[model samples]
Target: MNETIETLLNHRSIRKFTDKKLTDEQIHTIIKAAQQASTSSYMMAYTIIGITDPDKKAALAEVSGHPHVTQNGHLLIFCADLKRPVAQATSEQYEATRANLENSEHFLVAAIDAALAAQNAAIAAESMGLGMCYLGSIRNNLARTDEILELPKHVIPLFGMAIGTPDHQPELKPRLPISAVYAENEYPAYEEDVAAFDQELADYYESRSTNNRKDTWSEQMIRRFAKPMRMDVTELVQKKGFNKR
Candidate 1:
């Protein structure tokens, strides 16, 4: 097997990080790698905010509910920014110009661009022997995050990443079985696939229960989606001027 494939297969999130601060060169290199990621239409409809301020980082930590957002040696925020395009269109609303605000294509472009950039940065950081964790909670505090970052209209936080040297090793996370995900030239067939997957997930959880964590896959999913969304992020994003269009 290829070394890169092996490394990717062994991928796991690292929460515990060393106190060592990364140098400027390392930071620049990682950012460079992120810039090299595939972008949509070369619009580069994404923004990455590097936080070095303690207060900002601490505030972000509060937003994420992940303490490491502040404690980690480095923190970066990935943003799906449609603000620039909106501004350009508004400013240059000439006879031949003016983009449709309700265009869903632009929103998709920003989101996909941000995701690609994030994956590039994650892989790059790992190659440098650095530990990193992605924070999906950036959306949990959407309006507050926009205020904190001073984001203009049509911009939204996609996620955040905390990077540092590894201090402790975490157990590998189990992925869904191929039968659960892979479909041969067509959409997945249900019932049999789902039942087989549920069992595999249950077994994986059982194995992890030895660490004093119940680790039930179904329980986790239930807890995540059972409750009403406190943030109502879709509405919030609409309020932010994307309008999900």
Candidate 2:
């Protein structure tokens, strides 16, 4: 396999990181790579907030409930931003543009843009031999996170990333089989495939090097979605001037 394919296949979410920090050059390179990611209609509607202060990082860590937020060599918060475009609009166009920006479609675009850029950043960090973990728990309390970051309207902090040198190597987690994920003409039923994957994932959870647990992928999904999760997201997103349409 090619080096790039190998890198993609060997991906693992690294949680534990060494004290060795990323150099300024490395940080710049990673952000540049992220900026190069494809954007919808040339609208690079996102902003990256690099947290360097100890107090800010600590506050973010509290919001995420993950100590790694403070312990990582570097922390980056990726935000979906529409405020920049809105700011540049002409006085005549401002009202119409603001109305368009409030649409749910634009919000989705910003979110997708942020996610694409984040994946690019992740690949860049891994290719440079650095370990990184995505901090989705930052969204667990978006209101507090927004307050901590001092974000303005039309900008929302979607997620955070913690990057650094590897302090621990984790086993690669198994994914659902391709048959269950891919289809040619139309979406196909994959009950059998899912059942098989459940067993595979259960085995993986039971045999991993650390934090072994007797659980299946299906169970994990159920546990995650069976109840209303982050129920405050709708209200908070609206507060940020998004999804109003």
Candidate 3:
């Protein structure tokens, strides 16, 4: 396999980070790599906020309920910022109508842009022998995250990535089998396949999270499906002016 494929296959989220601070040149390189990622329609409707303040990091950690936020050497927030374009259109005397300002397509473009940038940054960080972990929980405190980042309307914080040197190495987590993911032709019916896959997942998690606990993938699925995250996302997005259909 190629080097890029190998880098992707060996990927594991690093939770524990060492005290070493990233050099200014290293930070620039990572951010530049992220900027090099392809943007949808070249809109580039994304913004990155680097948080180094101790107090702010602690507050963000509280919001995320992840202790690593406070402990990590650097926090990189990737935001889907539609407001930047709104400002551009407004400044250029173009119609910054509400409909034009907020649409599912526009939202998707910004999200895709942010995700692509983040992945690029993550890979670049790894190339430098640095540790990194994606923090999707930054969205857990969406309102607070906006306030902390001083984001304007049409700008929503999607996630954060914590980066630094490694204090510990996490084991490679197992993934779903190709049969469970990729289909041969059209999508095959695979509800039955999930049960066995979940068993594998449960075993994997049990081995990883707890000390040899008898946890099954079925239980995890039940726990996850039992409480959804998006049911409340509508109300949250409306607060930022993206009222979905």
- Stretch of 10 with least lDDT, candidate 1: 94-103
- Candidate 3, residues 1-245, lDDT tens digits: the string is 98777778788898888778888898899999999999987888899999988878877898898877877768899988877765756544544356755677777888899999999999998877888999988778677777888887778888999998888878887776777788988886667778778788777766775355766677767888999774655666767866463
What lDDT, from 0 to 1, does candidate 1 have? 0.77
Ranking by lDDT: 2, 3, 1
Candidate-wise lDDT, in order: 0.77, 0.92, 0.81
Count of backbone collisions within predicted model 1 = 1
Residue lDDT tens for model 2, 135-191: 999998999999999999999999999999988888887887888999899996789
Distance from true position, residue 44, model 1, in Å? Answer: 0.6
lDDT of 3: 0.81
List candidate 1 segments past 4 Å from native: 85-90, 94-102, 209-211
After best superposition, candidate 1 residue 152: deviation in angstroms? 1.6
TM-score of 3: 0.90
RMSD of each: 2.5, 1.0, 2.2
Selected candidate, larger lDDT, 1 vs 3: 3
lDDT winner between 1 and 2, please give it. Answer: 2
